[model samples]
Target: MTRLQPLPGGLPERFHVAHAMEKGASRTRLRASDLSAPFHGVRSLSLGEADTILDRCRSYVPRLAPGQFFSHETVFVLRGLSTPEWPYVPRIHVSAHRPAREPRTHGVVGHRLQTREPAIDVGPEGMPIENAVRAWRQCGRLWGLDDLVAGADALLAGRHPIASLGDLEEEVALMGDVRGGILRRSLALARPGVRSPRETHLRLLLVRRGFPEPDVNVDIFSTRGEFVAEIDLAFAAWRVAVEYDGRVHAEDPRQFARDADRWAAIRDAGWDHVRILNHHLRGGGAPAVAMVRAALIRAGWRPGL
Candidate 1:
């Protein structure tokens, strides 16, 4: 018996099964344990576990037919929006517009999208993908109210924003009773210029608890017209500012000193500043609301019925 010839090296990292066979790969060699079938009719050189979502996405790219693109939660991660940290890997969300058969493979949650709705766009990887508006709208399939708002804020206000408040409003109107009104409620509460999901949570916690909605990331100026600071959640009318200070990044001494000076200046300007940390929002967020409420009251805000 002769040892079978190894597969050709120049066949590309991920190759279609038919293409490999046409390139002189023997059926026996193609069926060997050396190649793993990540999807039907597509094989890959071992990328063990495919731990990250993008890796898994690329692994399945060979099988994506025309008109099919990534959507929903997958787009959230791919586009760098905040999502709940799961202990295990989540399935990829693949989608195609109406009349197309959606994928039903393991490790995939396929969506049959509305025809010509929730528009599509190209992603950073050059793959066909759902636009940020569509992704934010589709997240209603799996996300809750606060998360939906966070995702909305990210799409409309993040660096290199893909949508505007008008875009979101348009999408929500088209949704037409999606989630039995969850999308409508979230959209009404969603604010632009929100920097992070934690900020969204903080804002929602206060409003739901009867505090007035705060202006998101608005600039505050001193009596002399000099910019004092941009408060994360500014109650400008009452001279109160609420900010979520989740500084988990590696400390930059220069940035820290600048922040220290900024905080001091904010206080010196006679604005009541409420600094909210991770623990303040850990549970029911009552503490965060209470802290903001105290600051607002100190700044002369009165509750109304």
Candidate 2:
């Protein structure tokens, strides 16, 4: 038996078998028990547990052909968009130009395109990937209106946005019912400055219940014009704010202290603040909606006013 050579540095987590051969590993050693064969010609010594969808994707990189970009749910994971955990598909999604031949692999979803190639961008691994906006459009075929809105908000949020709402609108117009108009309604609901999917869900719940849509992540100023703090969802005119307290708030000590101080400042500024938890959303958001509604009413908001 030949002695196996050490792997070279700077290789990705998963690499082609040829790369190992270049590093002085014999084909026999490459098939040794220490290495795992993720794809036909790809081998890795440390293929971490394939628990999450992303963990599985790392194993499929070698099989991703040139001119093919990751799309659908795979792109959602790559872009860090919030999605449900269940319904995990082991198959990887690949998109390519017309005359696309679906790979013979059993666990891969191939999309052959007749229209002009969807816009392409590079992912974290420097591999060709579908741009965020185009990926969101592709996702419309699978996700519901609320989930799509959350995804759009994620794309358009933060200082360095992946894509603008205008960019998404343009893409939707170009698609024009190709996806059965799934993205059209979500486009209307999508807004900027939303920080998380839960926040988006809260906003959608309020609007669906006939409450005036609240502003997202707006800064509150004291009566003296000093900036108080930025609240998650606010009705500036009504001096009402709504916040979603996810597990991180209570689990992280630093965040817990910061949140306490921020809420105190908001209260000192004479604004009504409503804190929502995962439980509030679980029961169809009735408790949260009723709470926000009462606060809005007290602040002089009225229906059809």
Candidate 3:
């Protein structure tokens, strides 16, 4: 028995089948078990690339038409935004504008949108996607108030920011009661400078309990003008700092030590520190809210003020 001829060396890991055929590849060689078809007429090397959402999107790029681009939570995942995973299940998203039909590919979900260029951002690798602001607006139709605000806060977050708070506000202002005004409502609750979605959840939990909105990622300073640390949420007037303590800090020895030192310094600076955990966020977040309220009271915050 004779072995099949290998594909041309110049071909990429993921390439159009027609392109590979045009590049001096025989039909039999292209049908081999080594390559997997991620989309019709597209083949990937079938490595670990299929394991992630971003890789799956890239694999489908060859099938993307001129009017179609990525949208919703798919673009969020592609761009590394912290969106809920539920929205991304079952099928990858493909989008187009008015008058043009959305994609109908297998393993793809089509979205007919009211968006075009300028609102569409072509990323570094040349993958066209809805800009972060427009995607946030589109997401309003899918996410609830908490997930919506959390996604926006991530875009406006000081670290790895995709857009500014002003960017979100501008998009929301133009939406004009779309999705029954959830865009505007989420914007009213969302804050800039939050570090993570967990921090956003903590802030919203406090505000929902009628606690005053705390500053997100506030910097602490000693009287000597030295920076202490950037606490997750801070009540500047009340001198209360609340932080979300995830498992990473507890499981990693070095990170745990640094967190300990940071918490100690905040206390030494005469501030009340509240540490919130995942359990506190469950069951309506009453426990975490109570903890923050106690810290506020310790710093002289009175009820009905």
Candidate 4:
């Protein structure tokens, strides 16, 4: 038996390699022994080079005699659940598979891939199995939480689940859970009939930014519940009704005229109406929240919760 030379700072050579690379070493390579630590030291190979880290690792794929591997998060990134924005790589939550042993580094610094699946699928980028499994798992959790709740609510109320992806994002942000974002994205892509894309995105931004959630397509009715008017988003308590006032509203003469009539009717019925345009959504979320907050405050909402 031979004792391998331990990497500097008592870290595995791969870990050292990854650490050094992250601190701005543009060009570096590793030998097999550098990855010979427990769990085959896959973390050492993870140098933060976003697009090419996997590509660089392919050189050793043909040499993966046995037991050598990559990290699970790395696999997920390659598959696309998380975008690489530098500093913090998107964390993939995969608690489904149990690891036989602990990883060398707990997070982005360096870590090993521990999965229950037998025989990882390797390619030019190494294990596609890891990325695919993680992506699928995240997607499942997302649908299980957000989509199921929203879909069930919509169905029971006899409402359509055809909402925008942006709106789904906001709902997910509000719930502060993976389940929400996943289901929202999945449902929006699969179903075609929900709110328009822009409206959905605006809805999402509003909710994610800690503003009070607004009702979508709220129907104002008579005291007998006979439908009298329809509004895009409404804060009934504040009597604040908001319309998207989109390009269609301005482009179509009939729609423009009808909108004026509708606002007048809403005013007559004692609702304070506020109209928003696409540009407002694009520029001033904080202002929008402030305006809404101000109105809600005037209507007797305590400022600090």
Each prediction's whole-model lDDT (CA) = 0.80, 0.80, 0.81, 0.47
* Residue range 26-103, candidate 2, lDDT tens digits: 787777777777667887768455565566667777777766778776787877776643463424677887666545
- In model 3, the Cα lDDT at residue 245 comes to 82
Give the RMSD in angstroms, all C-alphas superposed, for model 3: 2.6
For every model shown, what is its TM-score relative to the native structure? 0.87, 0.86, 0.88, 0.38
- For model 2, the superposed segments whose C-alpha errors exceed 4 Å read 1-13, 17-31, 85-91, 115-118, 302-305
- Count backbone overlaps in model 3: 0
Candidate 4 lDDT over residue span 238-292, tens digit each: 7767666666657789988887887887877667776666557655556555665
Stronger candidate by lDDT (1 vs 2): 1
Highest lDDT: give the candidate number: 3
Residue-pair clashes per candidate: 0, 0, 0, 5
Estimate, for each residue in 1-305, the C-alpha lDDT of model 1 and write its tens digit.
Answer: 66768787688777788888888898888777778777777788784656788887887887787778998888888877877544524458999988886788887899887777546777757767888787877778788888888888887685667688888778778766477888878888887788988988888888888888888998887778899888899887888888999876428888888888898899888788888998898769878878987887877887783
> If the candidates were sorted by their lDDT against the true structure, best first, what order would they fall in?
3, 1, 2, 4
- The superposed Cα distance between candidate 4 and the true structure at residue 258, in angstroms, equals 0.9
- Scored by lDDT, model 3 comes in at 0.81
Q: Which stretches of candidate 1 lie over 4 Å from their true place?
A: 1-5, 31-37, 85-90, 158-160, 302-305
| Cα lDDT over the full model 2 | 0.80
Ten-residue region with minimum lDDT total, candidate 4:
149-158
lDDT score, candidate 1 = 0.80
Candidate 2: the clashing residue pairs are: none
Error of 1 at 215 (Å): 1.0
